[model samples]
Structures are given as structure tokens and as C-alpha cells.
Target: MKVNVKYFGAIAESAGKSEEVLDLEKGSSVKDLKNQQIKKYQIQDADSIQIAVNQDLKNEVELKDGDEVAFLPPFAGG
Candidate 1:
């Protein structure tokens, strides 16, 4: 399955892009995808990241083809 990923804030800077397409194996969960991304991007502290699927926040959602995943770093706004 292939999914679209969007990066925000520090996540985007670390990834060096705002969006990307990820090719994942069948039955891959959101957590699995996140792990793969962390490995691919050499992201540190993957557990502290925030994620959304198709614009909705998710914790343990399963991914499907054409799903949009967003990775966001911790926000610090005053």
C-alpha cells in the first residue's frame, strides 16, 4: 500500500520536505509507518512526534492505500 505523508514544523525541516509518498507493505499500522519513516529519515525521538491520518489525529490507526499521513513536531507558540 502507498500513503501520502505531510510534515509540519520541525518535522518538515528534519525531513527536508513538506510532503512525500510512502510505499508500505500490506497490513501496516500507523505506528509501523512512523517507525519506517524515522529509520528512513534518521529522526530522533520518534515517540515524541505527533501524527494525523487524513487530517484527523490518530494513535494506532491502520493505514490504507491513498491515506494521507501528517507528522508534526511539538509546537512552541506563545
Candidate 2:
């Protein structure tokens, strides 16, 4: 299954791009994807990153084909 992954803030800088398409095994969880990308890009502060699946924040949801995952870096309210 293929899913769209979007990177924001520092995550995007680490990834070297804002978004990409990744192919994963069917039934993969959000944490699985997070682990894969975190290692692949060597993103810093992995624990501080937040992810929204298909526009919804999820921790352990099963990913489906065409789902959108956004990696958000920790931010401060100004």
C-alpha cells in the first residue's frame, strides 16, 4: 500500500522535502511509519514529533492506501 507523507517544520528540513510517497506493507500502523522515516531521515527530537493521519491525529491507527500522514515538529505558542 502507498501512502502520502508530508513533513512540516524541522521534520521537513530533515527530510529534505515537504512530502513523498512511501510504499508500506498493508495493515501497517502509524508508529511503524514513524519509525521507518525517523531512521531514514535521521530526524531529531523524534519524541517531539506529532503525526496526523488523514488529517486526524492518531497514535496507533492502521494505515490504508492513499492515507495522508503529516509529520509536525513541536511548536511554541507565540
The residue pairs in collision within model 1 are none
Question: Tens digits of per-residue lDDT for model 2 on 1-78?
Answer: 999999998899999999999999999999999999999999999999999998888557799999999999987769
Task: Report lDDT (Cα) of residue 47, candidate 1.
Answer: 75
Q: If scored against the real structure, what TM-score would every candidate get?
A: 0.85, 0.93
- Measured by TM-score, how close is model 1 to the native structure? 0.85
**How many collisions per candidate?**
0, 0
The CA lDDT of each predicted structure is 0.85, 0.92
Any idea what lDDT model 2 has? Answer: 0.92
Best by lDDT: 2
Per-residue lDDT of model 1, residues 1-78, tens digit only: 899999987778888899989888888998888888888788877878988898888457678899999997877889
